[model samples]
Target chain A: MQQENSVSKLKYFPVTAFSVVMGLSGLAILLYRAYHLGWLPLWAYLAAAFTALVVFAMFVFIYGLKAIWYFEEVKKEYNHKVKVNFFSAISISFLLVSVAFYGYLPFVSAGLWYAGVIAHLLLTFHTVVFWIRSEFEVHDINPAWFIPVVGNLIIPVVGVDLAPTWVNIYFFITGMFFWITLFAIVLYRLVFHKQLAEKFIPTMFIFIAPPAVIFISYFRMFLNVDVFSMSMLSLALFFLGLLVFLVKDFFRIRFYLSWWAYTFPVSALGIAMMIAYQATGFSVFKYIAVFVLVLTAAIVAAVMAFTVKNVVLGKICVMED
Target chain B: MKNVTVVVVYIFGLITGILATGFLINISAETVLLKEMASPYDFEKTVEVLAKRINSTKNWHVTAVIDQAAEVKGHGEGDIGKLKIVQYCSGKYAYEVLADDNRKKISVMMPKTFSVYEKNDGRVYIAVMNGSFVGKIFKGETYEILEKVSLEVEALLNFINFKFSLF
Candidate 1:
């Protein structure tokens, strides 16, 4: 009876599986960024991008059909904010891949990039309008709503030089404002409302992302360091410190693909520090950048290896058996 | 009397803030474009001569000569005049920049590109990204190397301009 129960518990096509893109692409860009910063050799960027592409391809092939199933499953629960926003992970993954390859293949990268842009526009519009149109409880709010918003900020990293100036500004303004609005809502939920569901606790790490990403995007947009850039960096550091204090709480949650949620925000902060070091030439920031890079890289590597092992063992995709 | 003084101070502060911001914006807007002179030579001859001159330069190797005009024409767009980007990289500088973490970011702007294009007026122009100003934003060994590279870039453009002047 216990064996049957275990088999029944398997999640062959969890929507959360798309989140592997977050780690794989995040690390790829991290390596590429490292290559740009001279932390890694030239071949390192190529190798990292190749690895991300392979993993992305495998994900598409392995979960392609099941993804449809996952979509249907989630669509049934579409009223849930978490399920609805999880769809944004797919779009965000495409954005990350586009950024990883952008330096190498501009034309092809642009194609994937615009796909992400359109996806974010459509998904965010639908999700936000649904929120405003519906009569929802305050407890429904969570950091995952920030996922859809984060994509706008991330667009400028790839789009600033590649796209038209107006387009770049559009994404920056949209992302910046939404982030502020969502930050207030998510913060209010955290303080006034009850503790989030266990699955959601890992996503608290996402709070680190807005400032981290804004730092990068703002630097790129202005090509100069100023009060705004410094403020973003400070906020990112503050969030990083906060996450560290909650490290024990992070470990208490059951491991799921949602754990991938923790990778990109820290990765963004790592890349942000590198940008700050470049802009200010501060050694301390460089050290912090390297430290964050190493820690995030290691975390991503461990999580990915464990995930692959679990997948192979039929412990993940297979029904509870 | 106190309220009147406070109102005057607030007005003065707002005007000063606006003027300062306007001054900053004006300074930021002053970007130097890398455009060189109009060549009497047509697109084909200019690109050919430019490619030869570039390859002749020490440590500079032309990696690719992209025929962007052919590409746009391939898209069924009616003929736009010849536009080509000649990509070249200095193996020496590549090593220098790639040697350290801070310098690696330079690769984003790497494989130095020169766009050679002709206008509707039949004038051919050569231009590059403003390297010097971009380099100044970073500090460290990367900044030193980038500054050096920017100077080298300026020298190359001047040399090309001088060559065209002789024609």
Candidate 2:
């Protein structure tokens, strides 16, 4: 009876939990760049990469068990509107970890990159088809809708070297097209519709990731600093500033697993700044890079601590209202 | 009433003067503190030649050559052109500066650096701090030592024909 009761809780293991891996892997890749710039010690990158890998494995193992034991429950999550979007987080975790290991382990990195690319492409297809077939109320559309789109943008960060140029470009163009379309829809939803729920408010930070990832991927492809790349970077910075301007609203909300949404986007912005500094050789960019790095570190640490606290208190992994 | 107007004018002038000074510093800081010259050889050859010359010089040793472009690429930021920083130090000069407690603070500038980079114009250039100009500001034994170091640095760089600087 005791074993059965404990096993029954597996049904509540939310698919959204994969987002923890996304956040950790993003930080690991950012620290890896900082390590190369001589801004951080090698141990910093190693620790972050190791932690991300371990946590990702743990989440995948647990979530896999949940799928096997509670197939119907897992199916319910996949069929849900908002919950389904986070499934792409699994593929994104693979791509980000692939980037973090690209320097030390090329073979492993290439394998993971292939898996991530194929998996993300499939997920993108499923998501688009789902959106077309289903009717979503305007209120149902939120920043979480951008997750699959953001995953596409992340492909070329490592895919440029591992895959053919045309393949990477294909992913880049697809991601850019969807990003613009979704940006307009999301903006319309925010301004014209009812406000997002409190739990979903942190997803607003998702606004920072697409353009920042686009900037990095664009720079990696062409290796140039042109007007288009700069505009993407500036747009990302503008959103970051706008979020900071409305920080009080964020502070008022209690912690939810969605808080993990704040981590990867901020990390992406910081990584973009580091790339900007390298491309332009501007001292101002370098200073901004360091500043964003420090801010990202603090945000990730705080979110992780809160996550651990909630897990210990049995506040997480329970049935939602 | 006249006295108050005079005070307001003086305050306005002082603020304007401070702003102008700050603007000037922002514009001139790089040129005043550093010097850049074109390198005849390509990026890799320039770094190799400088490292070989420094190692061959008396009492000087090449400490490290940092390939920043490779480093950036290795970490997945992609290439940012050819940028390398070469660090060299002389034990004799280091000891001369560090033997005194007061002069030890100058050790920050000890392992002198030379930045060899390729600009967008596809020309390779080498840049180093203007040690002599900086030394003159100190105006003491430090100035004498740095002045000598500057002349030796110029001599080591004589392989390139003197011409116009892109800086």
Candidate 3:
């Protein structure tokens, strides 16, 4: 029996299959363009870019089918096989670029690098459409038609020299919105859902890892992550509230661990923002505000760490088991 | 042991992602290195040249320096973006990219900087390449000066720093 939220699996049979094929082809051309690019030619880059956008359309289809977001077929392909393939594809692409970069093939390597950027953007879009809770979520309105809506974005940027630049910045902003919103919803689910923070908290260390990597990556790109960090800080605020709400239930050791899970990402972001504010220069109000927030976060994390010693690991956890 | 194994996998993924980013960043950083300029010019000077040449500042804010940006320290052998930020502007060029319709792509170029910076010793520097800008300008029938803008800017740098020796 399918869960109430799990919609039918076969809602997007044709659209999905077509999208997967186009996506595979686009990625194949992009990969070949990394080395091959003989018969395909310069226009092939445009073709791959176009095809990649076509792939983004299919995501709209998948999102349209909300409940059965993870059909057996979709799961089999994307969750396991495609994830490994794309991850390796990016990894190998990076390795090749590294070799060529040191060897001084900067021109060719730069082109491939930008193309890889495009691929990564596609992956980010896919993750948002499939995983996040938003208007684009599969279940709500079913915007499979929105595929072409997004594809329309490529018409302006494609075949132009500025295509990559224009498309990349555009996608970066949109992707940030999606990722931020998703992060918020996940936090919401954790707070209200109760059991979620428990299960995910055990893996909270994993939660801290990816966003840290993403923040670091965005930083390296010369992106002013003040906005992203601000969003992260907002999440930290909610986590703090949740921690405070649960403080009265001092006996629940596992719930307390959940608070720490939230703190990890929140504190990481608060620290990032503090560093940013320092870089921005000294506005007393801004500095005081950032200082207070960071100091509060530090206090929270310090308390959480101490709890592991004072209560959870030391006493509470010891008592529970 | 299972917990340790999981943590190990998590750490492994983090390292891999970072390595991937570093590898890709190298290509963009290096591209700025090899692509040479035809003359010695600073982006500010280029802005001046462009203003004089084009006779229009109405749509272009040429040679704008980006201030208060954090220096991208410890990047690598040739990471220039971390050092300096030089912004350029041309609404006409942006109009061209957007293809005279659907202004959404306009945000891509966003009247941003080409970003050039000189080291304290003035030996090393970094900047961005406008492959499309050049490609667009030169490809057309006019042997347009805009075609060689980034190259000229590089040349301008060579002049100022006496490194590439555009003179």
The candidate that wins on DockQ is: 3
| Candidate 2 CAPRI grade | incorrect
The recovered share of true contacts, given per candidate in order, is 0.00, 0.00, 0.00
| Model 2 agreement with the true structure over A51-149: per-residue lDDT tens digits | 988988898878876765687988888778898899899898889888887644544565677678878999989889888888988889999999999
* Candidate 1 residue-wise lDDT, A106-134, digit = tens: 44455566668878878778778877887
How accurately is candidate 2 docked according to DockQ? Answer: 0.02
All candidates' lDDT scores? 0.73, 0.82, 0.38
Q: Please say which candidate is ahead in DockQ: 1 or 3.
A: 3
RMSD of 2: 20.7
Instruction: Tell me the TM-score for chain B of model 1.
Output: 0.75
DockQ of each candidate's interface versus the true one? 0.02, 0.02, 0.03
The candidate scoring highest on lDDT is: 2
The full ranking of all candidates by DockQ, starting with the best, is: 3, 1, 2
lDDT of 3 by residue, A1-321 (tens): 544222333432322223232223323333222222122333434453344344444544454343244355444435432132232233223222322231123344344444545554565455445433333322221212222222222221221222334544564355345445545555565455545323233223223323432343343233334566445445544444554566544434444333333332333333334333333433642554355444533545464465446543333321111
lDDT of 1 by residue, B1-167 (tens): 25576578768956875665455334433322242455546788878877887688787789999998899999988787789999988898899888887667678888998888999877888767756445646655675576567645644553332322211
Q: TM-score of each candidate?
A: 0.66, 0.68, 0.30
Q: i-RMS, every candidate?
A: 18.5, 24.9, 16.4
RMSD of each: 17.9, 20.7, 20.9
